[model samples]
Target: MRRSGATLDFDVDTTSGHPLYIPNGDLLTANKWHHVVFTWDGNVTGTNAKWYVNGVNKTLANIAGSGSRTSDSGYSPYIGALCSGCYFNGQIDEVRIYNRALSAEEIKRLYLLGN
Candidate 1:
């Protein structure tokens, strides 16, 4: 995930080709703490992507491209950036990735736990 201006760019590379990209604007306040959760069931059909902000589902459905989500974990994940130009202009504290998509209740628990 990369913050492009006030919105976020969620990109997940797929095994069958094409990367999934989701965009949501003004989802975060500068210099403030926010809990964002993105869930995908590995099947992209221009939908089925959910964005939970602060424990509530924001209903983001603008997924670009299509394919099965990648299962390879050989590549290293970068926090603030994937390259020079595309970089998150804020601080990132902790990040967690799961094997499967988490439920709404589980995501809420995480937000509540942090608070």
Candidate 2:
């Protein structure tokens, strides 16, 4: 996804059910909050996909596929808030992505980073 205005870029894979977040436009504003989460239900192979932010989950599912791509070719990218041209003007802290659905314990961990 591309950021036109103040927003974020993300993509979800239907085959693996994994969500990927990408920062296309520019750095976030200072002293603000920005985060992202990704969950997968199938298999994740290779490292084609990665969390741009620090402290995010690296590998997700255990199932292996034929190819070594992080995302499938047929899935459409998901964009949030920001569009192309426009950019975010705030501080971004503690971006998180999970392979399986996050439990209450995991959510709390993320919250702690922001606070």
Tens-digit lDDT track of model 1 for 58-87? 756466665566664786676667656667
What lDDT is obtained when candidate 2 is compared to the true structure? 0.43
- Model 2 off-target regions past 4 Å? 1-82
Per-candidate total of colliding backbone pairs: 0, 12
Candidate 2, position 25, lDDT = 44
C-alpha positional error of residue 92 in candidate 1 after TM-score superposition, expressed in Å: 0.9
Best model number under lDDT = 1
Off by over 4 Å in 1: 14-18, 67-74
TM-score, candidate 2, is 0.31
- Per-residue lDDT tens digits for candidate 2, residues 1-115, read 3333543444444444544444444534545554554443343442343323223443423223343335446644333433354444444344444456665457557656665
